[model samples]
Target: MLKHFNAKSLFGMSFLVIFVLLSSGCDIIPGRHMRDQAKFEPLEASSLFGNERASQNLPENTVPRGEWYDIESNEALYTGMQDGEAVENIPIAVDRDVILRGQERFNIYCSPCHGRVGDGQGMIVQRGMKQPNSFHSEQVRSQPDGYYFNVMTNGFGVMYSYASRVNPEDRWAIVAYIRALQFSQNAPLDVLTEEDLEQIESVVE
Candidate 1:
């Protein structure tokens, strides 16, 4: 029994030694001191930068990190602005896949207010919210693509911005889908091909 007790005591002592070493090992760890070096906290006053501020101004031409994309360059892709004006186009490729993605995103985020057909008669409006302008209206149909992006990003009268909820690319996708909805309701019969006319006739019949 004494031998067993001694064994346990030795094991406890070894564990205590290990615990002390690990708990205080930060002082011996290289670079940890530098990482946690006592420096001025942000906005604290100091004479280091000649302005009596610890925060030195960033160097000139300091490009932001991950700025290779057009989004970071004040391009039409992210800000929907070009030459100080709202651009009239989508900066990305417009294709079936993009349109489909737009449709999915629009159905999720916009259909609640704009309706599936873009008629501003969604369930939310039916439930007593103010109805928004229909996208098929001539005013909206004539608007530049960037207008939609801006609205989605910054919101409009009686509408909250979707910027927090929708990413920039998805916001453009939703704009494309909105254009599709506008075309769907405003397609001129005079421009319909013979095959398309026949298809419509069959549906009518």
Candidate 2:
């Protein structure tokens, strides 16, 4: 049997059904069905925003904004010199206090690769890692203070720069300790006489 229906009631029911369908597709409502969609893609130019070519357009050697040298002053930052000129002719004096500090810092920072004694037989080497040359090596001994400084600043071969890890003064201190280690290893026998050895034995007793 067909029941008589009001036109207004039919129109209202149709509106309600359409609203329900739209509401069900919305992601905001829990358990609503939504088609899996990819995120909106960025414009083509946006991908190149940080590329090197963009950086090249900027001024040359201009220190980036908010970045600065860690040194105390501009003079301390870099001594302007090319290759051979970098080596200081003045003797590099050993500061006992600096050497002691360097020894402590070296034990913490360098001992893993370069041993506490600077012999390069660190634990890493004991575990089969590549061995670094000893500080006592002739090649190393021949290196000037500036050479050590440069190596610490720039690094060599597989070793990375220690400039970031250690400060200039501290780097110099490490050089002093390295010299001390070298001196101990290559000291003349005459420096340790029989009387000196007897005095040492007396102290042990």
Each model's RMSD to truth, in Å? Answer: 6.6, 10.7
Q: Candidate 2's residue-wise lDDT over 25-120, tens digit each? A: 677566553554533343323335566233335568867653245443433233212444555521334567888987887887788988988889
Looking at model 2, the pairs that clash are none
Instruction: State each candidate's clash count.
Output: 0, 0
TM-score of each: 0.66, 0.55
For residues 167-186, could you state the per-residue lDDT of candidate 1 as single tens digits?
88888888889888887888
* Range of the 10 consecutive residues with the lowest summed lDDT in candidate 2: 72-81
Model 2: CA > 4 A from native? 1-83, 86-94, 190-205
Q: Rate the local accuracy (lDDT) of all candidates.
A: 0.87, 0.71
User: In model 1, which residue pairs have backbone atoms overlapping below 3 Å?
Assistant: none
Best candidate, lDDT: 1
Return the TM-score for candidate 1, rounded to 2 decimals: 0.66
